[model samples]
Target: MTEHPSLNKKQKQLEPFIRDTFNQEMSSNEGIKIADDENSLKAGDRGPTLIEDFFAREKLAHFDRERIPERVVHARGYGAHGEFELYKSLSEVTMADFLQDPAKKTPLFVRFSQVIGSRGCNETVRDVRGFSIKFYTDEGNFDLVAINIPVFFIQDAIKFPDLIHSVKSEPDNEYPQGQTAHDTFWDFMGSNPETTHMALWIMSDRAIPKSFRTMEGFGVHTFRFVNKEGISHFVKFHVKPLLGVHTLIWDEAQKLGEDADFHRRDLWTNIEMGNYPEYEFAVQIIREDQEFIFDFDILDPTKLWPEEIVPLQKIGKITLNRNVDNAFSETEQSALHPGNIVRGIDFSNDPLLQGRLFSYSDTQKARVGVNYQQIPINRPVCPVFNNQRDGASRYVIDRGKVSYHNNILADNTPSEVPVKDGGFVTYPSTVQGMKERKTAPLFKDHYSQARMFWNSMSAVEREHIIGAFGFELGSCLSSAVRQQMVNRLARVSRELAEPVAKKVGVTVPEVEESTVTRSTPAVSLMNTIFVADTLKIGVFLADGFPGHEVESILKQWKDAKLHPVIVSNNLGEVSGTGGVKLKVEQSFLTGSPLKYDGVYLVGGTGADDYFHNQARKFIGVVYTHFKPIGARKECISLLEDMDINGKPGVVIEEDAQFGRKFTEVMAKQRFWERPSYLYYV
Candidate 1:
C-alpha cells in the first residue's frame, strides 16, 4: 500500500455526501428494480410488454430523457469505471492528494469518444478519439478531458468553433455524416495552414485506433501544477497503455464501421472474458521559468513538448477493471470537463482549455438538466453542501430557512470554509492583456512539426497515412477542396502531397514555404510503444489430428499472456489427435479473423474442403497484414498450396516442430520485416 496525499478539510467533509448520493441513486426508486436492468420487461407469452409496467415506463423514460444534447463534437462515446493507483508521490511538483500519495486509490470514470460522430455514431471511423478521465477523489472530482491525439487542429480556442463547423455535416445538406472528407474541412485546413501538424496526425493510423485499450491518451494542453508554497510548474498529462499503442489499418477500420457497433462489442466481450485494460499515467513536467526554452509555445495545444526534452514520468496505473452496469444510466449520462480539478492541480493560460472550461459545464446544463451535476453519474463522490438550491431535478434537501448568504436565517448554515484549512485557491498568476483578440506569433508556425511527423513515420505507417489522405480526399466531391488540401500538404512535405494528389487524380500543388521551420521529432506514431501480450489469435480447427499440439500451443500462449481462441466451423467438441478434443469457442461462419490479432490453422479429419476454403480466405487476410500465422505438418501442406510458405510471420513444421516455431513466431507479432511491398486487398 502506497501513501497518497490525504484529503484536506473540504474533501473529508464532502466524501460522505457523494458516497451517500451514489447509494441513494443506486437503490430501489419508486418500486423500480434496477438490479435486472440489462433486460427489458416482456409479457408472459413473450409477445409484448404489459401496459401496467411502471418499471418498464421508468426505464424507457430514463432512456428517452438520457440523451442530453450530444456534444457539438466528441459526441459518440464509451465509458468505464476504474481506480488510479499511484506508483509514487509527486509532492515535489504538486500537493494534489491523488498525485502525492501512492497508497490512495482514487475511483475514476473514463469516456472514450469519436470527435466528429453523434451519440449513436460508429466507433472505428477515422477521427480523433476523446480520452477523458474523471477522478472521483476524496479532494474533488478532477477531470482530464483529453484526446487520443497529442495535438489539436488549431492553436487558439477562438478558432475551435470554426474548426468543428467545417468538419461537421455540411450546413446545406447535412450529408457526409461523421466524416471530414468534404470541402469545408479541407478549405479550412488549407487556409489556416497552422492545422498541418494535426492534419498529418488525423491522416495517420492514430486516428483509427484498434481499441480504446490500445490507443495512447493525451491531455493536449499545457497546464500547471501548484505545490503548498504557491510555486507553479508547467505540465502535460499522458496515458500510455501497458499493452502499448496499436491501430487497425484503414481498410479494416472501414469494414469495422460497416457495423458501427464493432468497438462496443469488442470492449464488452473482452471485459466479460476478464481481459481488463490498463494504462500508465505519465506526466511531462517543465519548470515555469523554463517554458520559454522551447521553440514552439508551451501553451500551444497544437504543438507538443518533445519527449526528448522532457521525458515522461510514470506516476500511476489506471485499470478499467469493471464495466458499466447500464450504458445509458452511467456512460451516457456522465459528463466530463477540464475545469474539474483538485487543490494541487491548476490550469494554465492555454486558450483552448479556457474555452473548454466554459463550454463543458454550459453544454452539460443544456444537454442534461439545469442541475446536471446532480445526475448520479456526473455527481462527485465528495460531499456538496451549499446554499445552492431549487433547480430542475434538484434532489438536495436543504434543512432550514435562509438559502442565501449573510442572512440571519438558519444561523448562516453551510458557511464558506477558510482557504487555510482546505479550500480551492486558484493559482494567482498575474493576468493583464489587451481585450482585443489575436493569436500570438508563436502559434503561427505549424508545418515544421507536421514535416517532422511525416519524416519520422515507418514506411508502412507512412503509406497508411498517405492512403488515408487519398481515401478522404477522393470522397470529396469538390475538386477545390482536394486541391486546397494538396496545396496545404505541399507546405509540409512535397513528398507527402504528390502521391496523394496523383491518387486523387489531381495535379500536385506547388511548394509554398511557411514561416514555421522548427520540427519536433517526438510527435510521431513510429516512436510509440508496441507489445504482444493480450494479442488475440483466432485458431480455426476442426476435429484435429493433434489435440495435444493445440493444447501445448495454448499453454505456451497462456504463458506469454496472449489470447488464443479455438474457433471452428461449428460450436462443439473439436476432436484432436488420439481423440483428444477442444471446445470450439466460435465458428468461422459466425466471426471473422479481422477481430483477432492473428490466426492459426490446425488440420484434422473433421474439416471438410469447404471449411478449409473458408479458413484459407481468413488466413490469407491475416497473412496479408503480416500478422502471425501458425500451422503443423498437415496444416503446412494446406498453406503451401496457397503459397504461404517462407512468408514473414508464417510458422510451419515438416513433422512436429510446430509448437516451438509457432510460439516464437507469434511472440514477435506482425512482421514489419516482411519485404512484400504489395498491398493486399
Candidate 2:
C-alpha cells in the first residue's frame, strides 16, 4: 500500500501518546505474562512431565491464581493521576485544609470504569461509568466515589447487591459481557421502580460517553461539610468537564469496540500531546435547615438535586497533568474510601453512602492486603505517624520499642493532637433512626424525575435513549423480561416506552402519570458544555500530494490547539510537491477513524486511484455517522461530485481560509443540526 506524506509527521507526534497507554496497561494488567523461550519441563526427553521443574510450576501456579475476585460491579476500569487546585477558599463553610487554602494543590487518583463490563470488556459499552476520585489531602485521604451519571440504580445500599446481581451476566451462562439489556437487569428494573430515574439516564447517550475525558461526573449521594466552629451544611460534589459532557452515536460506539481499547488510546494520545484533560470541581451546597425545601429527598442516591434547584458553584479545577509511573503501583494500588475524610468533611444520612463507608475498607483488604494504606500509592504526602502497629504486608518502618498507647517509658509517643492543633474531629450531627429496618417515604416515588429526564431531552437525545433501550432489551432472549421492562417504562412516559415496546415485539401497557411532578431540565447533556480545543483530526493522504498546502493548513490547526494525525495506505514517508514530504503516522490496514475525533481528506493529485479508494472508504465511514469532514481543493471534487457538498458538517474548501473554517466546525463536532434522515448519504 502507498503511504501518505503527512502520516509520518503525525505518527511522530502521536508516538508518546500510544506508548504511554500500553505502558500503563502492561504494568497493571496481571493476566499478561511473557512466555519463556526455553524447552518445556519434561523428564528424559519429554517422556514425562517433571515435578522438579520450577519454571513450569511457577507458570502454572500464576495461571491458576490469575483470577482475583473481579469487582462485584464496575470490573472494567481505566485510571489517571492529577492535581486538584482550589479557585478560592470556603473557610466559612469548611475548615478542610485542601478547600481552605488556595495555595495548596491536592494530588488525586481517579478511576473511570464501566459498571457492567468484565476486566477485558470493550470501552464503548452502553453502561454507566464509575468516576471515582481519591484525593490525598493534607488532613487525610478523602474519596469522592461517584459515577458519570448523577443518579444510581437503587435508593438504599440494601438493594445494591440485588441491582448488581441482576444487571450482571446471568449466573448460569455468564452472557452479555458489557451490556445491561438482559432479562435479569430488565426484570429487576421492572420489579424495583425506584430505578426509574436512573433507567432514563442509562438508556440515554450519556451511558455511551464519546471518551472518558469528555464525560461529566457526579457524587450520587449527599454529604456534609463542617466548619471549625462545628457549623454543618449539606453538600453534593460535581465534576463538570471543561470539554463538556459529550457522547458518540450508538453506531460509532458499537464500531469502536472492534479495537475494544479505543478510549484508552484516545486519552493517552491527547494527554501526551500536552492537551491534558481538565474539569472544573463544582459543588451544590444546601444549608442543613433548607434541605427539606426540595420536593424530593436530597439523601436519595437514585435522584439528583437538579442544577436548577441548586446551581453548581465552580470552586476549582482538576487537571490530569501527569500519567501514572506504573499502573499497578500508582493507578491500581491506589485505594479510595469515602470514610477517609478531613476534619471539615463529613457524611450525610444517605443510606448507600453509610454502607459504602464500611464496604470500601473491607474490599481494599481483599484487593491490596490488610495494610493497604501502607502501599506507596495510597500513602499520604504529609507525615503519617500512628500508635497502631504492624499488620499483614506492612511496609512502613516505624521506629521505637513501645507501640501500644499510654506507655510511661515511651512517654505516650504519637499521642492524639487536639482539634485546635489541626487534628480531625468528626462533625457532630444527631442520629435518630429506629432499630427497625425501613426506607424513607420520600424515596418511594421514582418515576417523576425519570419522566422529567425523558421529557427534557431534545428529539435527537430522546431518540438515542429509545434506541439504546431497544438495543439492550433486544439482546435479551427472554420475551417476558423484555415486555415487563417496557411495561414499566410506560409509567415514566408513554412516548419513551412506546418505541421501545414496539421494537422489542411487545405491547405497550397503560400507565398513569407519576404523582411526582418536579423536573430538572438541566439533567440532559444538551445543556452541558461541549468544546473542541484538543479534538484529534486524522489526515488521510498519500505520496505526490501538495505538501506545502497541507503543511500550511496543519500549522494553522496546531496554532488553534487542534491535534492532527497523518494516516496513509502504509506507514512511511510520502514525497510531496517542491521536494517537501510528510510522514505517515498509521496505515489504513493498522488504524481506523474510530480512533480519531474527525477525518481530514487531503488526497493529493500525485496519489493513484487505489489510494483514492482507501481514502474514499475512510471518508464514507466518517460521513455516514455525521462526523466532521474536511477536504482541500484537490479533493473538493469528491465532496461535490458525490453530492455531499451541502451536508451539515461537510467542510468544502471555498476560500484559502478553509483551514480556519474547518477548525471551527471541528470545535462544534457534528452538525448535530443536520437531520438524521440524511445520515446514510
Candidate 3:
C-alpha cells in the first residue's frame, strides 16, 4: 500500500488490535475445546438429549444473539481507511484547524453505502448512496455525513422517518430488499411534491454507479464555514472522484443479481491491487448575505444551488489507500454524525441536517452499546478528557474523587476552555422569532429547479430517465398512483412526462412548458472526466492465435493502465501460431459481459462452431451494452459474420495503426452515440 507520510500513526494505533486467529484450535468462548460441535449434542445421536450439555447451549446462545439491529437506513455499506490532505488553506472562510493548514494530513475513515436496504441487500439498486466520512482530527472526530446526490427527498427533518418508511419494503411482505422502484415509493413521491427533484435524481444514472470509486459525493445540506473573525459563509461540500462518474445500464444492473457484491468487490480488489481511489474535495461558497438572494432556498435540503451561479472552488483531495480490517468492528460500529463538527465549522437551519445531528447519535447508541465511542474503531486518535464515567462497555477508568465537572476536588479539571483556547465556539448569530411549524416561501417552489435538472440531461440521459420512470411506474398495481406520478412529472417538463405516460398507460395531462429552460452543465454525467486508467477489458482468444499481434495490443493496454483478463472456451494454456502460449484465466461459461468495462475479440483461429458461437454471444452483449470492442484481423471474421463491423466503438485491427487507434477509443469508456444505443430501451 502507498502510505502517506502523515497517515502512518493511524496504522500504528490499529496494528495492536489486529487479530491473527488463523490455525488456532476452535473452542467455545471460555477456551474449552468441544469433543463434538457437529450434531449439536442433539438427542445424543438419535437418543434423548440431556440438559447437562453446556457446550451446546453456549454455542447456540452465541449464535442466536450474534446479530445486532441493522441500521434503519443505509445498512448495506463498505468502508476503507484513508487520510485527507488539504492542499489549499481555507483560513479566509473557516478557522477550522483541519482546514487551516496545508502541511498536515488528517486521517479519515469513509463508508459508502446504499440507503433504504438491510445489511444483506444487493449493491446495484435504484436508490441514493450515502457517502459518510469521519476525520480523526486532533481537535476530535469530525464527521461529514453526505450522500451521492446533492438534494434530498424532504425539506423538513420531521418528515424524514415517513420518507424512509415509504421507500422501504412493505411492512407486511418485506419482499424487495435493495430497490426503490416499487409501488410505495412512487406513491410517496406523487403525494409529496417536495420530493420531485430528488425523485428525478434517483431515476438517473447517478443511482446505479458502476463502482463506489467512480461516483461523486455531496454534503446535501448547506453548512457554515466560520472564520476566526466570527464571519461565516454558507457552504455546500462536494467530493469529485478522480476516476470520473459512470454507471451501468438498466440491463447490466439487473445482471448484477448474480454477483450482488460487484460494487463492494470492485473497491476491495482495486485497493488490494494498489489502485487507490482518490477524490478532489470541492465546495461552493456563498456569502451569508448572498444566501437569501438565491432563486432556490439555500437551507432547503430538497434543493441545490446551481453550480454555474456559484462555481465549485477546489481545495483538497482524499485518498483511500487501505481497506477495512474487519467489517463489523471498523465499518459497522463506527458512528458518523453531522453533529460531530469541529471548531471552524457550524450548522445552518437546514431542517434535514438539523434532525440528522440528533438521529445519528441516537441510532449509534442503540445499534452499538451506550459507550459506542469507547469502541476501538470509533475512538479518536487524540487524547480525550471528559468527566463522563462508567456505562455499559466503558473502557476508561476515572481515577480518584472526581467524575463530575466543576468540582473543587479535582480543581475544576476537565473543564471547558474559552473560544481562544481551541475549544469549540459557535458563531454568534442574532435570532428573534417564535418557533412555529412552517416552511419558507422559497422552499415551496420546487418544480423550477426540477425543470432545470431535466433540461441539463443529454439526449441519451433523457431517454434513460424516461425508461426508468416507465419501468418503476409499470411495477405498480395501482393505476391511480402511476397516473399521479405521471402528472407530477409533467410539472417538471411535458417532454419528460409524455414518453413515460405513454409506456405506463397513463394519460398525458396538458401542462404548460417550464419557463426555467436554462441548464447547469456541471450536474450532467456527460460532462464528467474519462480516462483509460484502471478500466477492465476482457480479451477473448483460443489456441493457435497470433502471439505477436496479441502481445502488441496487450502492451498498449498495460501502458494505459487497463486490466485485461484472458478468456477462452476453457481453462489451461492456449498455443499461438508464433509458438507462444497464453494462460486462460476465464472461460465462456465463467465470464459475463457485465463484469468488464470493455471486451477485446482476438485470435479465433482453429476454433470450433461452439467456440465461435460463444464468441458471437460475447460480442453481441458487449455491443448491446455500448462498450468498446477491438478485433484483430483473424477475429474480424467473427465480428464480420455477425454484421456488427464498423460500429461506433468497434475497432478492426487490419491497418498497422490499429492498436494505437483502438486504445484511444477505449479511453472514452463507452460509445453512447452508437445506433444500437436506441435499441436498448
Best-performing candidate as measured by lDDT: 3
What would the per-residue lDDT of candidate 2 be over residues 1-681, giving only the tens digit for each residue? 334443322122223333344454322134544355366567777588888766667667878975556666677777887888999999999988889988878878788888887888998978999898888787777888888988888877777788888988888999877788688888898888888888888888898898888888898888888998899988899998888888888888888879798777777776777788999999999998998888789999987877787888999999886666566555566677777887888899888898888888888888878898877667666778877777887877888888888778778867779988998878778777669888888899878788778768888888778878888888778898888888788888888888889888998877685555555667767777756688889998877778788889989998888888898878988777877788888888887867667888877656777778877777777777778998876787777777677788888776788899888888777767756654311
Ten-residue region with minimum lDDT total, candidate 2: 6-15
Q: Tens digits of per-residue lDDT for model 3 on 221-317? A: 9999999989999899999999999888887888778887989899999999989999998999999888678788888988888888999988999
lDDT of 1 at 414: 73
Task: Say which candidate scores most in TM-score.
Answer: 3
The global Cα lDDT (0 to 1) of model 1 is: 0.79
> Which portions of model 3 show Cα errors greater than 4 Å?
1-7, 23-28, 31-56, 676-681
Give TM per candidate.
Answer: 0.89, 0.90, 0.95
- lDDT by residue for model 1 over 146-203, one digit each (tens)? 8998999887777888998999988999867887878888888877887988999999
Each prediction's whole-model lDDT (CA):
0.79, 0.80, 0.86
Model 3 residue 9 CA deviation (Å) reads: 2.8
The TM-score of predicted model 3 comes to: 0.95
Candidate rank order under lDDT:
3, 2, 1
Better of 2 and 3 by lDDT: 3
